[model samples]
Target: MAERYEYLPHHLLRRRVRDVASGAEGELMAVVNENVSDTVVEHWVELAYIRGSSGREFSTSVDNIEPAVAI
Candidate 1:
């Protein structure tokens, strides 16, 4: 099945693409997907940091790591 684009609003994602790339739309899309993956990982890392700071332990957990799969 095809993926839905609603998870990240198109306009916001478009802006992110502009912020991260200077290339064709197709190329930018690839970059955006990669960016989304990185962003998800970053969020998890940040959570871990927060938990550690609060005297709570947390393992690093990313929603998804596969490039072609949506979380």
Candidate 2:
């Protein structure tokens, strides 16, 4: 049988990533797995950044984020 969900690779954690659709950039904080049904699972990623003195966070599908290019 095929797998229901694929977890993000460990090496990707704490790495910089960019949201493909939004162009937002931040550090990859975590991977979350949600079971939608007996046979269905969804993979998500938490991206975070500090703006001034506060920290901000957002979650999106793992597929929507990619390693950020350093300039």
Candidate 3:
């Protein structure tokens, strides 16, 4: 059986998210699917922070991303 993946909507784009393992926070940029032979094998979430012209960006498994909690 294929695993189900949940994707965020356009309105949720740029929302803040945190990595469950690393505890790093960033803006949710996009969701990517890795396909093999017409089947999706993995799901990834692109994260980044923009400031002027320089910022850090990275991609990780969607399972690691979660909505950032306010404190």
Candidate 4:
């Protein structure tokens, strides 16, 4: 295993992530940009800024994405 991405800045760590809701295969992507502390969430949920391969950037809770293991 490489490393767990939780509890860290997205830009500072390897950004191979996948959209859990998309339900599509092969959507692994790298973080093109980030502002880990830029968003405010309910109940103090930490959000990460992510820019996917489609060039869509958004701030979302870490639960929305999962680390895409490299094979």
Please name the candidate that would achieve the greatest lDDT relative to the true structure: 2
Candidate 3, residues 1-71, lDDT tens digits: the string is: 34343444444357887777677777777765533234454543333331111267766666677788979
* Cα misplacement distance, residue 4 of candidate 4 (Å): 26
lDDT: worst 10-residue window of model 2: 45-54
**lDDT of candidate model 1 versus the reference:** 0.21
Q: How close is candidate 4 to the true structure, as a TM-score?
A: 0.41
Q: In model 2, what is the error at residue 70, expressed in angstroms? A: 0.5
Could you estimate the TM-score for every candidate? Answer: 0.15, 0.58, 0.54, 0.41
**C-alpha lDDT values of all predictions:** 0.21, 0.60, 0.57, 0.48
- Pairs clashing in candidate 2? none
The positional error of residue 54 in candidate 1, measured at the CA in angstroms, is 48
What's model 2's overall lDDT? Answer: 0.60
Best by TM-score: 2
Cα RMSD, model 2: 6.0
User: Model 1 shows how many backbone clashes?
Assistant: 0
Compose the digit string of candidate 2's lDDT tens values, residues 1-71. Answer: 34444454545678888877677787877775534354445443333331211257776667787788999
Candidate 3 vs 4: which has more TM-score: 3
lDDT of 3: 0.57
Which sequence of candidate numbers ranks them by lDDT, best first? Answer: 2, 3, 4, 1
Q: Order of all candidates by TM-score, from best down to worst?
A: 2, 3, 4, 1
Q: List the residue pairs that clash in candidate 1.
A: none
